[model samples]
Target: MAVRELDDLDRAIVYALQENARKTSTSTIAERMDVAPSTVRTRIQALEADGVLTGYHAEIDYERTGLQLHTLLVCTAPVPEREELAERAQEVRGVVAVREVMTGQENVHIEAIGRDGDDLSRIGRELDEIGLTIEDEDLIRNEYETPYDGFNVASE
Candidate 1:
């Protein structure tokens, strides 16, 4: 499929929506960008159809939600087994996301949230059983995110 290019108004709309998708209505976004609400709606539908805007999600504070332990597991496996290992890691309890890194010594990065250290330990053991050798792991102390600006959008 051909890549659909986002126009200037699309970039502004995206930036506004990224700030707060649930609260930001099409009319609000259009008003901010000085465009019609119908135009904004059409562009948003087009963006979704072209797979540019995949999905809207809420950023939850896992720590506040009682899942206090958050970790990043850097593991290595044989190239052929890397994808399988990632998929297996997801099946392990507390494991949320498993990203396969194509290049580097650590081929897999697992993002896990747990109730405590024991929960994380169990996940680690499960990964080990799946033929993943944990090179290193880090406890996520905190996360900081900023509103997405239109910096990534190409200028016309």
Candidate 2:
């Protein structure tokens, strides 16, 4: 997709939303940016329509939710079929996310949460059934996120 140019107001809105999409209200962003709430709302709608702002996602702590196993399943799928296999991997029970990297080996990375070893084994079996070669499995300790600094253009 072609990149869209974002102005200071657009960048500020995206940054604020990224920081806390659920809690950050349009009014709040307007207040922070000293703009009209309607303007912020319109800009947000435009951003979404333009595919600049895709979706808001919750940061979940799977371990706290009693699903102890947070595993990163590194797998390789035939380059021709990688994207399709990644989408299929998302349907697997216990699978949380599937990332298709632009690499030959270890191209598909699946993040999954399971209660026990058996559950993880089942997930792996399902993935294999769909023609992904499981290269390695690593337990995820923690993940952290921060909003893109480039979106803080208003501050700069």
Candidate 1, superposed: residue stretches over 4 Å from native: 151-156
lDDT of 2 at 50: 95
lDDT of each: 0.84, 0.94
* lDDT (tens digit, per residue) of candidate 2 on 1-156: 888989889999999988899999999989888999999999999999999989989889888889999999999999999999999999999999999999999999999999999999999999999999999999999998889998986658
Top candidate, metric lDDT: 2
Residue range with the least summed lDDT across 10 consecutive positions in model 1: 147-156
The TM-score that candidate 2 achieves is 0.96
Candidate 1 per-residue lDDT over residues 45-94, each given as its tens digit:
98888888898888888998999888999999889888877888888888
TM-score of 1: 0.85
The TM-score leader among the candidates is: 2
